[model samples]
Target chain A: MFTDCSSSTTSRLIHLYNRNGVFLPRPSVSQFSLRTTASTWRCTLSIRSSSSPSAIVIDGKAEAKKIRDDIKIEVSRMKESIGVVPAEDSSEEEVLKYVSGFNDDPSVHGVLVQLPLPSHMDEQNILNAVSIEKDVDGFHPLNIGRLAMRGREPLFVPCTPKGCIELLHRYNIEFKGKRAVVIGRSNIVGMPAALLLQKEDATVSIIHSRTMNPEELTRQADILISAVGKPNMVRGSWIKPGAVLIDVGIKPVEDPSAAGGERLVGDICYVEASKIASAITPVPGGVGPMTIAMLISNTLTSAKRIHNFQ
Target chain B: MFTDCSSSTTSRLIHLYNRNGVFLPRPSVSQFSLRTTASTWRCTLSIRSSSSPSAIVIDGKAEAKKIRDDIKIEVSRMKESIGVVPAEDSSEEEVLKYVSGFNDDPSVHGVLVQLPLPSHMDEQNILNAVSIEKDVDGFHPLNIGRLAMRGREPLFVPCTPKGCIELLHRYNIEFKGKRAVVIGRSNIVGMPAALLLQKEDATVSIIHSRTMNPEELTRQADILISAVGKPNMVRGSWIKPGAVLIDVGIKPVEDPSAAGGERLVGDICYVEASKIASAITPVPGGVGPMTIAMLISNTLTSAKRIHNFQ
Candidate 1:
């Protein structure tokens, strides 16, 4: 019964992790079979041995599906009871004007402005214009500041980092008093991931382009998160003996035999890391699926808050 | 001539570093003698040997005096040409109304709401009410979020952490690729200090109350910042040899022979740290003086920006 529900949830939306790390949905009957049968979604496990790789693969697809199932029920209940549904809109009009329109609209629960605005547009100014209350994307500076601060809570957390933390929570990984290292310091992923880890009472060190020795820090982490967007940058040797690894980076590398002449890879060298790590998440079906799930979750939360729904 | 000018600058304001780490001015003629000859303000250096403490003392008092002198000239020039001066007001009225009044006033360049409000008032709500443009204290979440983001700049940085960074810059200390550890996570000092260090390309690790082994992390830092308010909590053995130390924590310790039966001490055991560190800042004369200087500097910046005075 559980398997049937999860598979149905996963097949409802086909998510593609684009180069910009945004997940776009495509509804297709043909892609359904490919998703179930693909090695990407398989939860592979092996017994620990010197000859064979052995690490518990975290099934992010199933985990995200489970979360979505719970959110689906809550959203349904919210809509049925309050007659309110979350709304979103994308427009090419003057950025500030469009943002302000959505900000003032009573019906709009959440507002997200797609990134990489035209070269002529000032990205910071456009983002700053989004009303903090309706900023479901959680990119607003005020939201981030509150997230970084102790005793303060952000209305919403950025989807990808929130997904990473959710995965850990689902797995029951202990964060308190643990040393965690995050590679890359991009505002969206690495930086927020580090902040979240620190908030959970884990001591966090951020490694970046300017870091002199990343391996030294990585070796000390009980939990390691890498979001540098480099293919297989973290080697097997970089893993602590039993560290839980969360790789947010997904990059395409050419593979002639693979579908579309390419395959996805994470910052971690998975085949080698599997031999040493206690648990790991695969590149294609890992953080990518969870990111989309978090977007839906945030939208639901915004709607609930807006309508004062329980 | 330089000495005479510095003494005059120092004497103009009789500043005290109060319990809350805020500098309060108590104008008085009698305080002048205590200001100059007091051991608190004196910069003491000893020869390097087994028998003597060797670290070069960072004279924050002299540096702050120099910075204030420069700001004074600029403020005078702006006032003469534009007929505008920075204005500040503290009121006991309702917080939001008072904040909005200052936010709308054309002549008010900066707004600072003293912290630790009455029990009935929400602190975050009051801080958030201050206009970001006039937030001279830099406590707003939006400013902090901007400070943490790459390629983004905050209009104002909190005075204490800004002072810490300015002191490093003035002394020509390097940040890029260095390992820095901040020993606190307060919204005001330690958190922002860590963010500022990371912004300068330093790999930063924050050690807090829940950190399993703070000394282990502190020993690895090339630059160490201790802002936890525990007096002499960081021992000399916790420091890496020849590291640059910035001690922002100041607490009053009992001293029978001292005035008011108390003397200020920093997080670091200065007597022991001076022997191991390459350079160190003394508590009362260090970050305290620079904090007030940054407040003046930030106000000057706000005035110049408001009036378009270069």
Candidate 2:
């Protein structure tokens, strides 16, 4: 079927691996829209035919705001129809109790136990308590596992990584045959980001502290995503010219000029990288806003899945 | 602390990534009967300091036999003391009923539903029914998720990949700083195998059907693991001379002279690869035996975990 499609003008097959690792022909475009880029082109793994000479800065703040607005509308609609008032939360147990309630409630689309719970609380246990069906954050191990897999659809993707990918999608960054390097491997960002890149058909490599010649690896990447919270760890020399850089790292460094006595910085030397790279995200505006926006998106998606909404 | 161990004769720390991907110094050396060759020679990421002039065939058969004997003894003792009998099964519900029973049973430590269940049943759903603590196969999504992430430990590593790593361990093959390539990304073998390699500080790359110029990727590996079922797909030229190869793929190719009208083969061209490669696993005697051994080992570990065995 893919060969048949590949020959036609409707060549919409994105490369995908099956559960068996067999290269089967599955169409990229689908009715259910659960379709991922599924292709069986072993011999001819070509880059995207379309060319975008340059990348544009993705407006994560505006994009996130729109999603939040959409979710707000949905929440209001639920409130009017079902008398669903938002649950109150302050303490750990209270938060967990509410999450448990939402887990059972058909009206509740998503459950989020915001991080930095009381020091005494066990975060893993509490987070695990969220029903996987409503795990919009996609922090659950099963969800993470599904996300890491080639052919599996995670119920939800971690908002930060999802947002990172979403930004690329919105900006039309082609990763199909690119060499991508992720600086860190954090479950929240780096690891999931690597998985996301692989899903889009990029040859991905994950570099860590143990990695030797990290700059050499970074320089080889056409797309570089750095999530390590080390301010300016990635120098301009480490980046490949014309590479698409997505900096997820947000660090606080002492800054006398800033009113707060500290300023936010990223893993990559953004000032230098912006000059060197073709497209890059800033420390404050790039990924920060997208995280919340993705949360809203995931919540909306969960609601749709839970309620069987079109 | 690994730093303490690094100062002495004992320097074994497996390259590990955490759930958050924070590089945690987890000691891989265990008092357990089954211990992997976990080492901490970050400075000495060099290929095996001690040389095997020729590729040594890892005797997975003898190793498996030893493990099986130990498990058999443990099982016999379990049977005698607890009077635990094997559960009966046929239908999906019945099988699930037994699995749920094992989940609750104080005596039953591990649960394994042999593959290729009834056509009417859902395999993934039935497998999910098994308690993760007793999922000896390590096929649970949580386990797999943990395996994929850094800073998290899966209760059980999938057998074939574990065996592949164990062989390297037994042979003193060093992977740190080595570019390792995986030829496929199946859940059972390739994907987990790549993770295991990454855990051991190997710079890993996965080549799939969508991979363009796979030979280029394979040639870059100091360690290559091939799990694609296609027999003799990997040739001598694809190998890096002195590179270590683990052939996870076992295909039963048609052979008129063979007794069963078929002969077992691996993904790599053994005749060619053995000559070019430094170390390699043979088809029939390699990963196949280790898989069963790992199940027994997992069952024992589960029993220890369940019964509070010291």
Which candidate leads in DockQ?
1
Q: In model 2, which regions exceed 4 Å deviation?
A: A1-55, A69-98, A104-110, A114-136, A257-261, A303-309, B1-54, B76-100, B104-110, B114-136, B254-262
Give me the candidate number with maximum lDDT: 1
Q: What is the Å distance of residue A139 in model 2 from its true position?
A: 1.5
What proportion of true contacts does candidate 2 retain? 0.43
Residues B57-150 of candidate 2: C-alpha lDDT, one tens digit per residue: 6667877887789778887777687765232236778768867987999777567654546587789988889877667677666787888887
Candidate 1 clash total? Answer: 0
Clashing residue pairs in candidate 1, if any?
A: none
The ten-residue window of minimal lDDT in model 1 chain B covers B1-10
* Model 2: per-residue Cα lDDT over A1-310, one tens digit each: 2332233222233333354554432322211111112221222211112333244555678777877887788877766766553332356677678678778888775676545455777789888899876676787778887876767887778989999988888778898768788877677887788888888878787787566667767887889998877555676678888999998977565444466855666666654566568888877888999897886666566555555555
Model 1: how far residue B237 lies from native, Å: 1.2
Off by over 4 Å in 1: A1-52, A87-102, A105-133, B1-51, B87-102, B105-134
Q: How accurate is candidate 2 locally (lDDT)?
A: 0.68
